[model samples]
Target: MSTTISTVALGDDIAALPRARPAPPARRRPPLKLAALWPRVRGWLLAWPVPLAVLALWQLAASYQWIPAQILPAPLTVAATFVDLFNTGELQSNTLISLQRVLFGFLTGAVLGLALGVAMGLSPLVKDYLYPTFKAFAQVPSLGWLPLLMMVVGIDEALKIILIAKSTFVPITLNTYKGLQGVPSSYIEVAKVYGFNRWQMLRRVVLPAAFPPIWNGVRYGLTHSWLALVGVELLASSEGLGFLIVYGRQLYQLDVVLAAVVVVGAVGYALDKILALIEARLLRWRRDAF
Candidate 1:
């Protein structure tokens, strides 16, 4: 009778305890479209603030006349000048000419740089014989060579191309040589252990290892070529974006100068971005390998 009483008390105590409630329905996520779109939107959001702030500051300065309009024209004035140039087809033609020169010069320099770099990297004798002369040559700015090059090639397309190529060549050759030299000795040893021949070793081990720096060189080479092209145009050519800047300054049309400057910056940024995309694509394998 006592045992039954105790059991009944225990049952009552159990019944008095709170029951477990079900979890609230899993919170629903937003649609997949929105999820994917967020990243791109976020990227733009992150990128836009600086430029927007600069624009605001520029507008403020213009409105307040903090700087003379003649020296630093309003942003809108520059935009109008850009539009006018575009309408006249002057901007497009000049831009195309600059692009052509950069491409031609960059290609020429890149090819020669690759060859020279590879030779120096692979052959000690070649490096020893050429490095001193190359270093001295590189020390001289492209402009320093102008007087001599002008005498040799005259003030023509050849002169501009040679200056641009020289500008490109130094960086490319240096990077390529360093890249090749930087490859791990262990990697070469491993390749040799696997019986890799010269071609096989280079193709499978050396080139892959060195490619990143070589590609970097190519990108730098292009940038150097662009800078050289602009300098050459400014001093010599009657046509091209650089000349436009000179023309605007001469006429005291600061807006036109700013417009041309804007275009130059935009083009350089775009080219760099293009090269970056290509680099990312080509080096995707590195991500997996690591």
Candidate 2:
């Protein structure tokens, strides 16, 4: 009877204990796409001072004999090299050649990409026929095509231009296709309600909406094409900045290599900034609408 009473007492104590409540559902944080890109903008703002600082530091180190001068020339040496090359007209010629190649290649590729993208967006048959094949092509890096291109074009200006064009074409085509495909149904409905015919709907409703993304793709394509152009030039060329780097390496002049690198980076940054300016102007509607 005592054991039975003790068991009943333990049961009462266990029944009196509190049970745990389930955890409250976690609240999801909102997306911060634009704001997350703010840090990159800030870094861009800080970029101009970097090269200057590097120059000053290098000059100080070289003057103090902290390292061999040939290994890392003072910024003054690089400047003198620059001035000498400029006066000799070699720099001007090489730069012009590179610019011409870029212009020819980029314009050709961008036009084709735009046309192809439009066809894909408008014609289901074309999309089904081309997109899968295009996706496979995109998997091959630009550098991977260099040997094949050289065999066909024989390491001449044509090879460089063709490589640049290929680098530009794929991204532009892909982005443009996506941009057109993603236009909201609401916009189409509004156009229809306003009695827009097919051409009217496309021109007034679709084109403007798609332009910004298409332009962005072109900007990226330009960047990639420039990089590919440099690689191609480095491998086989008599002129251009890529050739400049290769020439410097062959002559064992680190200063010239560094100078060429600086030039390439500066040119790329300038191109991007120009594109950004254009984007801001053309997409003013985005600022208002968003």
Candidate 3:
């Protein structure tokens, strides 16, 4: 009878205990649309508002003669000038010439800069000998070299190319050096423990770590080269986009000058966009690249 009473008490205690509750159902997300996949496209479209507003204000100013037409030129007039230049193929020829010059200069400078940067980065002795001189030379602007380049290379294609190359070289070398310097000592130690040869170490460890800054330098170098090319052309050449601006000015055609300026800005923007696309594709592995 006591055992029965104890069993009854145990059963009552078990019934008094709280039971486990079931989990709520998982949320079901909506399927993504095609447009939803490309956030960059939306970002790019959003960027047009500022430019469009500026353009609208410019047109308004032109319509009201807020600025003298002789100096500012109406947007419509500039458009007409662009159409004329395009039909004549003059714009195309000049643009092509400028692009070719920049490409040649950029390639040469990038190659040489990479070599010099790697040398200085890897060798303390080379850095000690060359870095100070390079920094000093780099303090001088691209146009500052024009006079010396004119004396040495003359007012020819060679002079323009050399100046552009110099503009490109400085940023690339500096960035490459900085990138190499920032590589983790721990990474190098690990590489050493793994018995990596010099080439293996550079290929497997250094290049990956240094690529981001190096790529940034290359982008900046390209921009510098373009600007330097225009400056060189303005000072010396008779057949490039800069000369088109000078020629328009000489003829008192503000519209022509504005048209040329527009082309210059458009081309530069296009170059940057191209470089950005290339960077994005190549560095997709990076967390914050581009």
Candidate 4:
């Protein structure tokens, strides 16, 4: 009986010995509180106040005849004209032409600007010889070149393209040169310590460091090119969005003019937003106050 009692005691002690407990089922993380994003939503909503006020004022003026109907058509009239032009494909065609001009001009100008800029940045002699001349040439507005360009290139697509390209070239060249020059000395020293060759140093150190300012230059170049294209079209072209504006005015149809103006503004805004989005994505490595 004592042995049995001892055996039973031994069994109880063994059972009481700590055994690994299965981990309490992992506590699940709570889902993100989407409701907490209300502030951001409110902020975006608040941004519309200015545009809304402008629209309201515009409508009130149209209703009260504060401005002559011929000079400033009702917003509704402009909206209707926009719809008509869109449905007829008139707006699309003109916009497409303008976009094509910009694309060709911008690409050509960017490539040339980048080459010259890199050369100038890399060689002091090139900068000394070319930089001053470029500055002087750039000081003249794109329109100022239009008359001379027309005389040489004629009032054709080539004229518009060249002017747009010139507009794009100046800003990009300056920015690229400045950006490359602005790269930190420490980065160059580090590259040298790593025994980087010229190509490796430029690719691994210079390009990344210079990209932000170069991108800014590209943005400005595009904006300037668009403006230049429109101005050229207004001055010389028979077709394009700018021509549409001129045609509207000549016909005394303010609605058409306003519609074209609105489209230009919208397209410009859209392009800027697109570039901004791309810039943000590419520069995710950058830390900033915003």
Which stretches in model 1 have alpha-carbon errors above 4 Å?
1-46
Q: Model 2: per-residue lDDT, tens digit, 51-147? A: 7787788889999979898788888888888888778987778878887888888987899889999999878999999999989998998889888
Per-residue lDDT over 178-233 for candidate 4, one digit per residue giving the tens place of the 0 to 100 score: 99999999999999999999999999999999999999999999999999988988
Tens digits of per-residue lDDT, candidate 1, 1-290, equal 99999999999999999989998999898667988899999998999999999999999999999999998889999899999999999999999999998988998999999999998888899999998999998999988898898899998889889999999999999999999999999999999999999999999999899999999999999998999999998988888888999999899999999999999999998999999999999999999899
Candidate 3 lDDT for residue 60: 91
What are the per-residue Cα lDDT tens digits for candidate 3 across 159-213?
A: 8889889999999999999999889999999999999999999999998989999
CA lDDT, every model vs. true structure: 0.93, 0.87, 0.92, 0.93
Candidate 2: stretches off by over 4 Å: 1-45, 48-53, 288-290
Per-candidate TM-scores read 0.84, 0.80, 0.84, 0.86
Pairwise TM-score winner, candidates 1 and 2: 1
Which ten-residue region of model 3 has the weakest summed lDDT?
A: 281-290
Give the lowest summed-lDDT range of ten residues in model 1.
Answer: 27-36
Q: What is the lDDT of residue 79 in candidate 3?
A: 98
